[model samples]
Target: MDMLFSLMSPQVFLLSCMVALLAGVIKGMVGFAMPMILISGLSSLISPELALAGLILPTVLTNGWQALRQGHAAAWGSVKRFRVFLLVGLVALLISAQLVRVIPHWVMLLLIGGPVSVFSIIQLLGWQFRLPERGHGWVEAGIGGFAGFLGGMSGVWGPPTVLYLTALDTAKTEQMRIQGVIYGLGAVALFGAHIGSGVVRAETLPFSVALLVPALAGTWLGFQIQDRIDQVAFKKATLLILLIAALNLVRRALIG
Candidate 1:
């Protein structure tokens, strides 16, 4: 209450909660984009640093639920299957996170947003791509590195990860679980990295904690919707959302 108000006014707080709920719902349905939505929406109402801090806990917790929804065993399987990606991404994320204050925001946004938007548009136009049947390790490492680099700077890594998964033609349930595993681990690293970067401190901690209620509630609702959708519908929904998210990133870069 007092702590949350300290971060933003009551009206802003209300709007921020609404954004969190929306972000959570989308995350639940498609298994990504919470950070992009949170940073974009909350940054409009609050400082970017505070917005980054505010998203930390909710992203962490929601991703935890997403990762475990299928069971621990399945989540572990995803971890093992994508160990190279996870290792490279986490390492890159930790290293790039330290550069957050050094890099220009627009540069990072444009670099990630443009390619992702193009990729999504191509996919939506019925042009599909798949990873090579042999020797994909290098490809996974490259995409993971790119995702981690963007994630460390902006807290938005879903686009590239989603791109990689889509290229693999991953099944819906598996894709959801894999995203949770990837993002959940990455979120933990982000929490740690930002704490060291002084983005998440005592002052911003409460604001992050306060959003958990609405975020969780929205994710539960999204899960209900997700359960009702078939694989084709899920893929379409994911791509559409990805396209919108990518375009929003581009818009922010251009507008800012």
Candidate 2:
């Protein structure tokens, strides 16, 4: 508590609480929006690196629970299907951790946001797209590399992963479960990578814990509202949010 207070101003604390709450709700509902929401909201007040650090543990905990919630059968299935991708991505994330300080934040934002935005727009328009048939290993590896690097730098990996999953036409329940698993794996990898690289220091722990309460609260609220929303409306809302987040990333990159 004292450490949390020391690291954040009253206003920043309050704002972080609100953002966490909202992020939690989104996560509970969508199983994937928390990082995007939190990073997008917190980046204005905190350095991007700190914001990324603060989310590391909480995201790991939440997503680990989410991934395994559906029982071992489903979880294992997802793991088998995406194991190679996951392994490659995790390794890439570990490598990216080393470069966190060397790489400019804007460069990461541009790398992640530009392709993500373009892909999201293409997806929203109902275009039929597919990954290349040849060099499947290389293609998956490349996506994983980019996702892991950006995830380490910006704490946002969902765009690439989500796009791939969506393209696979995964069922809603399966999609959620897969997302949970991917996030869990990514979070665990991030914890090790960041800690090894000195990004997850003692000072960041208190703030991460402080943010958890609001995140849980928001998640509960989002669950309550999720069932009330229709599918079309949900997709539209999600797309809008993605576009806004992408724009925000682009703006941040350009300005900073």
Candidate 3:
């Protein structure tokens, strides 16, 4: 309790928990964006490093839940199918994860905010990004590397991953499962990477752990809504909200 309070006041801590819950709910409904939401929201209340730390364990656990929701075999199949992306992404993530320790906060925010805003705007424009029907190995590796670089630094790689999946015209269910598998693995890499980077150390770890309950609960609620709602409608709305949040991040990066 003493350690947690040192990070934030009681009211601020409660707000951070709300952010986690909101992030989880969005993740459940759309199959991605939890890290974006967590980072964008929590960074408002705490230092980016602490916010990053706060998200680490919840990201790992929630993505694990998402990946295994369909069972191990399906998750393994996704791993096999996207092996190139996974391998490249993990390597890039490992390399770039170290940057967080030295990168300026505003630069980090801009890096996250810029790409996310573009992604959200492009998605909102109804432009269906497409790829050829043939070999995608090189493309996979490229986007994977980029996503991993961002993920390592900011705990965000969803925009590019979603774009790649969208380009493939992947099925909704398969896309969701693949997202779970990919992000789950990425989150695990992030966990290990940040641990080595000293972002997820003793003082910050408990706050991350404390957030798990609300995250889980909100994800469960989102799952229920996901089953019944018009997903396209819901996704569009979510993107709009993301656009707002993303632009706010950009604003902070530039002016604040």
Candidate 4:
């Protein structure tokens, strides 16, 4: 708590809690967008470095929980199914993550915001892309690589991953489980990559740890809401909200 208090003022702490809570609920209901929400929301209130650091623990926690929601056997099944995508994404994420320390902040924001906006809009427009079965291998690799680069730079890989899955026309149940697996594994890679890159340092660790409570609580509450809502409507609304967040990120980068 002392470490948390030292890293930012009380106002910022409250902001972080709210951001984490919102991100968590979306993630639990939708199985994506948590990191995007966290990064997009937090960057406006704090430095990108601190924002990334502060999200590490929360991301790891939420993903792990989401991934295991269907039980360990199902999670492991997803891991096996998407093994190549996971490995390539993890490797790319680890390598590109170090760039965070070098790349300009505006560029990072665009990296997070641009793809998110474009991809979400594409989905909203009812576009369903299809890859030939023969091309699935390279396509998966490509998507994973792009997602890894985005994740490394801004701690967000959900948009591209979601688009890829939807393009495959994966069933809703499996899509949710797969998303959990990919996100959980990505979160693990995020924790490790940032720790090595020095984004998740001693001074920043406390902030991340403190966010775990709100993150889990919000996710649990979101699951309750998910059961009663019209999923199609909720999804459309979520995409609209994400679009706004993405535009906000772009605006911040441009104005700054």
Q: Highest TM-score: which candidate?
A: 1
- Candidate 4, residues 1-256: lDDT per residue as tens digits? 7877877889989988999999888877777777777887788798878988888888887888877878999999989888878999999999889998898888877776787788778878987567664458888999899998888988888877877776676655677789888988898888998889999888998888888998899998877776566657656755776687687777767886
Q: Quick one: best lDDT, which candidate?
A: 1
What lDDT tens digits, residue by residue, belong to model 1 across residues 1-256?
Answer: 7877876899999999999999999999989989989988998899888998999899999999999998999999999999999999999999999998899878887887899899988989999998864588999999999999889888888999999999988988999999999999999999999999999898899999989999999999999999999988998899899888788878988996
Across 1-256, the per-residue lDDT of candidate 2 in tens digits comes to 7787787798998998888887888787767768877877888888777788878766887787678768989888889878777988887788888888999878888886787788778768877566643457776777777778778766788778877766565556677789889888998888888888887889887788788777767766765665577655655556666666787788778986
Candidates' RMSD to native: 1.0, 2.3, 1.8, 1.9
Q: TM-scores of the models, in the given order?
A: 0.98, 0.90, 0.93, 0.92
Model 3 Cα lDDT, one tens digit per residue, 1-256: 8999987899999999999999888888877888888888898889889999998888888888888888999999999999999999999999999998788878977876787789879888987668874687899999999999989998888777877886777766677789989998999999999999999998999999999988888888877766676657656755676677678779988997
- Lowest lDDT block of 10, candidate 4: 127-136
Cα error, residue 90 of model 3, in Å, equals: 0.6
- Against the reference, the lDDT scores of all candidates come to 0.91, 0.77, 0.85, 0.82
- When summed lDDT is taken over every stretch of 10 residues in candidate 3, the lowest stretch is 229-238
Error in Å for residue 184 of model 1: 0.1
Better of 1 and 4 by lDDT: 1
Worst 10 residues of 2 by lDDT: 128-137
Pairs of residues clashing in candidate 3: none
Structure candidate 1, residue pairs in collision? none
Higher-ranked by lDDT: 2 or 4 = 4
Q: How close is candidate 3 to the true structure, as a TM-score?
A: 0.93
